[model samples]
Target chain A: MTGLMRRWLAHAIFALAAFATPLLLSGNRYFAFIAGITFFSVLWATGMNLLYGYTGLMPLMFGGIAGISAYVTIGLSANGWSFWLAMLVGSVAASLVGIVLGLPALRLRGFYFTLCSLVIQTVITLAFVYFVNLTNGDVGISHIPLPELPGGRQLAGTAYELVLATIAVIGVVVLTVIVESSFGRRLTAIREDDGLAETLGINVTRQKLAAFFVASLFASVGGALYAPYVGFISPRSFDVLLSLNIWVMVAFGGRGTIWGPVIGAVILAPVPFVLQDYYTIKDVVYGLLIIGVVVLLPGGIVGGVKRKGRADAPAAVAKQAAPVR
Target chain B: MSDTTLIILLSTITTGLMLGLIFSLVAVGVTIIYGSIWMPNAANGQFFLLAALFAWSTSVSWGLQPALAALLVIGSSVPLSYALEILLVRRFYDVPNRNISYFVLTLGITQILSGIFSITYGVWSDQFQLPPLVPGVTMLGPFPIANNRLAAMLIAAVLLAILFALLRFHRYGRALRAVFQNRDAAALRGVNVRGIYRMSFVLGNAVIFAGGVLFACAYSFDLTIAWTMAITAFAIMIIGGPGSVLGALVIGIVFGLTQAVASIFASPTIAAFAYLGAMLIILLFRPSGLFAR
Candidate 1:
């Protein structure tokens, strides 16, 4: 099957699973919420993968960028803008900030690049927390109006889930295109060797900045959508931990693979909900799992599977020889 | 200036010193690991938190003296930290693109430890009162000073002095330094690079563990405190060049002082932002840090 067909099948299955989740599982509202959240998180991590996995730039500013977008969307909506417009503005803001941040990062590399990202994360979070006049700080903005559909069809509960799923589908599709374009190949080449890429006529700086902007765009959109879905916003929600989670998603999934982060999100996002009652054990288990996966799988879940598949012999012969092997 | 304002400034500066000393202790751990093994060890903050948790449990449960408790925390933590070095960190030394994994691993360990602590300790935010170690208050004429602050300062000073002295005089310290300056050369000269790496990781975390004990003794602690404080320490480690012990100390103290001073005139939240703002400015101007060389 073609790549497009594979993606469509995956998207259809995902949507079916998402819709069927809340309906089939009684008293699993928490699980349903997480399932929906997984979709958004997948988008966020994929954004991270574009920069980190493809471009080899570790942008730890995902949470901060997301926070900026979330706050902007919520802040604008408070001034009477529609929800979708607010989200759009949030994405633009994140992109602009991405450009601003990317400018400085152009000269820096390795630890320095990481440090710059850290500084951005810190500054953005601080602005959100202390800019109380606008952001409402720790108290955070609430009662974010749900998007209005035709015929005055108001979104709540399952209805809101449907809406977010549609947006998430659009985001994944758009991102897929971006990932398959010449830009994506450039990013991967840049990651492999920036010096060599530059020698070969690639504009390394521009590519890095472009990757940063694109990643930030997705992160901001994810964050904005997250605000209304959760029905609240706080600095606490978008802390460094969330940033780390984005890293974890990319790492645990196959980093460069287009669908890796989404798969990771699907598996990992629901674990907390599944282990909700044992919250304390949850983090420890989560940490152990990440370490275990990295150490054992090396190339992550998809990477490991692909390796195994390649190593397998001819199917007809291998079937008979499997036990011996 | 008014006497009240003057006193406030003096006290805030003093508090900043105490906070800075604690931060320096933690930053040193990250720095030492980076210095000796060339790894960021982002979980430095988590180790500090763990040490605080352990310190609190030991002090409250065993009714041990604060000095003994600090020592006990350090003693037990050293082996555990070294074990972590062997089991997890050792594998990553040769791998090319595993720094993010290292970050993720440390962060994962941090969260897990935090979760375990919250569960076992029940997340009740408690201040460990070491009345004997940190008494009530002392008067320096008109300037009344809390004994707790005074004791923290004294302890920090003594510990820092000892650390510097050890780094200068000890065989292990010299070996570690040799490794830091050139790992291959040091290894060629029979430095036992692997052994040095193990020792550095332990010492690095020991400092962090000690810092945590000092932090717990100074004020209050909850499960989230270390994680909250780690970001500030990250700023310090970056502001100060990585692998520079003196840089860590100086930058941490400066950061602490700035935060304390900001807290007086501005809201506490604004003070936190000021640290981040300062970090951004530093990154813009000198990406290598205040003293990268």
Candidate 2:
């Protein structure tokens, strides 16, 4: 097929796949909502992948950023701002926090920065719980207004799925554009070797901060959208668990590739539903799966396959770029 | 001074010191493991709770003494932890993701352990006690020190001293330290890196076991206790730096005091937030921590 035809065909296929989801999961709002979250999680995971996978910055605080975004959005809406405006504000605030945290955090390498993210997550979780007047002190912020689409349609129930799907698609496109940009190349370079990148005239700090901003932007957007869709916002909803869940998706699908996290979400998101009957052991299963993946399959399913595919390729001609780089 | 105010002040300091010791125990476990393996295991707290449960259950059912129960639990924890290290932790060493993977792996374990414990133990309040190990409150003029708190403090000091001695003077500790400072160098020098790694994991759990036994005696335990202890201990470690045992001790004590002071002057809710706030400020200003090296 011609390149243009292939492109058009891919787009059509993607659209069909998106539309087919509701039809396949029909009548179960829970399933539909989960599917929506899976997509949103894919976005979140992709953001993380951009950091950890593409940029080699494995931040464990993605959930904190998301939680903060949700809280901020809910707080703004409670004060009578429009839902969209509030979400926008929340996203910006979260991204800014991300940049600020990243500035100091980027100085650390590998595990140290990850530790910093954990500390950030803990601190933020405590902030939510302690600020009872604002966060309702574990009662959580409830009954957040759902997004409003054109034609007076409220973005809740089935409509919420459509809204989520649309946003997810746009998010993927934006991520793809950013991934292919010169700025992304700089991040890749810094990820490969910060010292080398610095020597080569790349602003490593700027790139790391930018990557942090980008990652937090997606996470916050996901969180802001999530609150209204879930119709409630709780600090509990966004914890280390959620962050790990997102990380699992990213890691399971493959990292560095746009399609990997989406694929991961598809495979793993419905897992809890399938095992809903085994509620108690679900955590055990989840735990084993995370450990198994980390130990047995570091490359993830797709990543492993891709690595195998490239094994025989001539190293001299092949790209010398790091995965994160 | 009013009786109520004096009591409040006394309790705060006493509670702070008790909590600080518990925090130190757990933080030392986490730090030692990190020092050796480079993986910060979040499951330390969960393992702690489990160790406590084992101790409590055996003691209640079989009528074993509290000290004997603690010894039994700590003894079992070493082997169980060794098994875990071999089965789960060893594989992650070469994994490119490093600490985050370890973080998530242990987090998964945390969920599993907590869930299992809650299911088995019924997620209700379970408190343990010791029969006057130190006997009677000692009054130093106006300040009264409870025997329980005094005993806990003493036991903690002894355990910490032994741990330091082991790390500072013992052959095994030297092997462990050799493995910790640089694994490759240690391996080249004929230090059994894998053996040390397994031993470190076991020792880490033993420390946690000790902490858990003391913790149960000091406070109530449920499924949430692990997380509660985990967060506070985590704060202490972060504030003090990840690899410093002494830092963990000092920071744990300082955090405990700060938390106590906050609770006395403000609400308990605010106290918790203040602890977290202190951590954030430390991280913000001194991310290397107060004593990281």
Candidate 3:
């Protein structure tokens, strides 16, 4: 089969699974809730993959962006705005924050930019906690109302799962288009060599800003979705560890690809939920899986699989086998 | 200035300098590892925690003198660092994105170690004491200071001074400088590059281990403080210009001072916000230092 056909078939399988998941759980609201959260994880991690996997910019502050947007959406919803409208405002604000941070930050090179991202995480979380009147301090804004399901009904249980799963699937499709476009080529080129890409008149900095803006939009949207799904929102929910976990997911599933981060989130996001009864095992297994994936499969599942498919292309395989420092 | 304002300024500056010295001590540890290994060790925090744990265990749990616990951390952590380099870090040394890969590995290590420590030590514990080693007032001219702070600061300064001298004068120091200049060239010069990598990792960790002991004694900390210290140290190292020891010390002190001074005018959380903001400004605007490339 051609690459296009393979992708479509995969998406077909994914959509079917997503739609069937609520039914598969069979009235287990807890599992259903966990699945709903998983959908959001996939969304956020894939959004992160767009920047880190393809663009070579590692954002440790994506969680804070997500938190900020969630807070905005919640604060608006408390004042009685439509859930979708609140979400929209929240996402746009997140993207604006993205642009502000990226414009100054993208000027720095490599890990220096990464350190700045860490500071972003610190400063934003601090802002969340410090601005008590705005963010409700550490107590966090609560009772975020459920989103309307477009047909004038509030979503709950399987309805929530189905909506989130559908949206997540749609997000993956959009991301697929993005990664396969000319813009995607430019992203990879910049990742490989910023100087050479700039020499080719690609305007590397502007492209970076655009990518960061979109990435933040996706993350903040996930945050916007989160408040309603869980019916409460807190600053503690989005922290540095969450950002670190998203990076791990992207890396594990495979960077520079559409499905890797989704696959990563799908596989790993549910572990802790399922293992809720096993705290010790949960932490150990989580840490072990992370270490095992990096040490054992440096290219992640996507890169490993792609390397096999491109057996005839030695140089490409070598390059894909390990990203250069 | 009013007496209240003057006192606040003096106390904040004094506290900032002390905390900054401790931060500098930690950042210099990070700097040495980055310089020698060419990979940023995010797992450096784990070493800090381990050192603190060991120190705490030796003195508080085992009921040893604080001085012995201080020696114990240096002794234990050196081997631990060397072992980690061999088992976890060595394999990724030559790969593409080795630095990042190692960074991820260190993150993994942090989680694993955190898990183990949480299991063993139960999240937060009232660990050993080193400050009470000199429990009283120390007069520094007209300003009376905590004897704990004075003692810890003196030890930290001496240790840092010793490290500087080692790098400046020792044979290993020469070999390390050579490795930093060009890994391939130093290897070609029969400099035992692998040995340097192992030794630098150990030596870097050992100092932090000792510093961690001192820091734990000097300040009251919980388990999660390791993560904060690591980030603050990274901020220090980056502002100092990555591989520069002097830069690490200077920047670490600056950050500590920033945090201390900010706290005087606002609540600590707000002070933390201000400190992070200042670090962000410095990180973005003035990345290069007296010694950063």
CA lDDT of every candidate = 0.76, 0.78, 0.80
Write down the lDDT that model 3 would get.
0.80
- Judging by lDDT against the true structure, name the best candidate: 3
| Better TM-score candidate (1, 2) | 2
Give the poorly placed runs of model 2, Cα more than 4 Å off.
Answer: A4-12, A24-26, A311-325, B1-6, B92-97, B124-149, B187-190, B268-271, B274-288
* Separate clash counts for every candidate: 0, 2, 2
Q: Which segments of model 3 are wrong by more than 4 Å?
A: A1-7, A149-152, A309-325, B1-14, B123-131, B139-144
Cα error, candidate 2, residue B105 (Å): 2.5
Residue-wise lDDT of candidate 2 within A144-254, one digit each (tens)? 777766677776666677667776776676777777788877877877788999999998877888889989998999999888877877778888778878888888888
* Per-model C-alpha RMSD: 4.3, 3.2, 3.3
CAPRI category for model 1: medium
Over A1-325, each residue of candidate 1 has an lDDT whose tens digit, in order, gives 6876775887677667666665664356765687678777777887888887677777877888888888888888778888778889878987888778777667766666776686677677777777789888879877867766667765667766666667666666666677778898788788777889999899988888888888888888888889888888888778776887787777788777767777887788777778878766887887787778767766678777666775774564545432111
**Per-model TM values vs. the true structure:** 0.89, 0.90, 0.91
Candidate with better lDDT, 1 vs 2: 2
* Location of the lowest summed lDDT over 10 successive residues in candidate 1 chain A: A316-325
lDDT score, candidate 3, position B147: 85
lDDT of 2 by residue, B189-270 (tens): 9998888888888888799888888776555566677877777777777788776788888987787787778776887667
